[model samples]
Target: MSTTPRARVGRPRATAGSTQLAPRDEILDAAAALFVENGFAATTTRAIAERIGIRQASLYYHFAGKDDILVELLERTVRPSVEFAKTLREDPSLASAAALHTLAVRDVETLAAAPHNIGTLYLLPEANRDRFDGFRASRRELRDAYGAFAMDAATDALRATWTLAELGAAIIHLVEIVIPLRRDGEMIDAVRIADACLRLCGLDDAAIAAATGR
Candidate 1:
């Protein structure tokens, strides 16, 4: 027999399933950055693929399209808050002010942990499209949760001056603004932000400190 090439053993090749998933995760990371930097509508598959050193066709192998990427990102960013809100709603034992404070802290922490400014995705016009219905529904659920929490804090006069829905939206907007600013290295404190939000709902400093546990 002629010289037979010896079987070479090295690191085992990645499983086909795992190999497939690696590119998908990479695509999502690149897409999140581009979507955050350029807005969902402005970002292209080509750009995202280029950023990750993959072909646009390869990106599509993982995601159906850019909207699919956006949907995944939204789920990753917003689903935890939605689930937390559900838990808070179910726990009738918890005081509303305390629950609201906890929600604020958790929401801020979630935003800060994201790799990109996920708040920017809320501003995308395409976010209203039928393809993004799941995202819209999840966001609406979060808003309703906030509204319920705000109602607990609203006085009769405050309720009359601003509807519970409006107050909830304002709280969400405040966090949205602060999250991105904090990402940019601003000296933002989560407890202080929570305290400020409680203040908007008419909680005094003592009440805020008590509710937020300082």
Candidate 2:
């Protein structure tokens, strides 16, 4: 006798409704929210799957485990700005002050627009673990880009007082203040922060306006 073929089973529908994202993106988005709200160590793969309304096993199709998800999320927070910094560095027409302003504004926008203020994850104690070393390195690259632009834009007086590392660290610190502002539900002005960076580099009002294209 001929036997009937078994019906093909498909992935289950997400309980979180139609997020309209691919499975991988859906997993990342869900994981970011859970990681930001619940803390990385406290968040389990099962919980991330539940939040997305998928099987815990299904999450594995896109990620090796919770650590993989966390790594990707952390990288997501910095990757765009880092890439933009590279682009700005290569261009010949952009002046250093203007370039710095542009990078700072773009970086601020990147931090502010992250879903659920995901940059706050940087503060997680678990983020210091070895697995996150790659993320730390990427952040340092971004910091160096900031420093280079700041140095190029710096006045003689500013340059005399601070080292390149100090200027870069200070600019990064200024931009990152947006994280706390976002976490507190305060409004952020990306251009304003960019202007602050220009000022920190010792640009006067006219110079800042020119850099800002105002």
Candidate 3:
């Protein structure tokens, strides 16, 4: 009953060989990849089975259906974000803030893009409100940890700064401008974005190359 789907950290557990998939494991992996790509609305169980080189009947040998796949994939992607947030909460020192900022920016970006379809599926109003019901505390903990991180950054910035909410909203607003353009096959002015983000935290770029690789 292994749940990992990939060979990497936090990835779903996968079968050793491609020849014969463990029924349940094969179905979960295929279904996860599909739902993360095409989303729940357009993907089919048949397609999932075919992706794993198995018959449709083989798929049903494990999963209840598509919804089960979608639910599991969502959990797999978001749970790590919650876990990462905990570390930020525990340490709010200057060094901790710098490290958290760098990691959080990269990790959250990866998480957001990992399953392109996951974002939109969960974005449906009311549909995702309770999606993390049992994981509610983790979500709150992540949020509080982020706020604490932001406050530490603001303290460095001086100017008696606005509330962490305002600073965060403002920073995210700037990022929203560049993300869509990058996805549209345009090169992002990553330097400019990183510069602006660092400035908000009262940090100057010795060379954003190190912190952001920009």
Candidate 3: regions farther than 4 A off? 1-29, 36-38, 55-62, 91-96, 105-109, 112-117, 125-141, 156-196, 202-214
Candidate 3 per-residue lDDT, tens place, 1-214, comes to 8887765543233333354546565566667567657766678988987786666665665666776666665565556756666664566453534544554564446444544434334443434545546444443445455455556655444527567656555554454444355446566554455456656666666534444444
User: What is the full ranking by TM-score, best candidate first?
Assistant: 2, 1, 3
Distance (Å) between predicted and true CA of 193, model 1?
1.4
TM-score for each candidate, following the candidate numbering: 0.80, 0.92, 0.57
What TM-score should be assigned to candidate 3? Answer: 0.57
lDDT of 2 at 193: 92
In TM-score terms, candidate 1 sits at 0.80
TM-score winner, 1 or 2: 2
Q: What lDDT score goes with residue 77 in model 1?
A: 69
Model 1 lDDT tens row, 17-90: 32234777877877888887787778899898888676666676677898898888887767898899889878
Candidate 2, residues 50-107: lDDT per residue as tens digits?
8878888788777889888878888887999999999998999999999889999999
Off by over 4 Å in 1: 1-22, 55-57
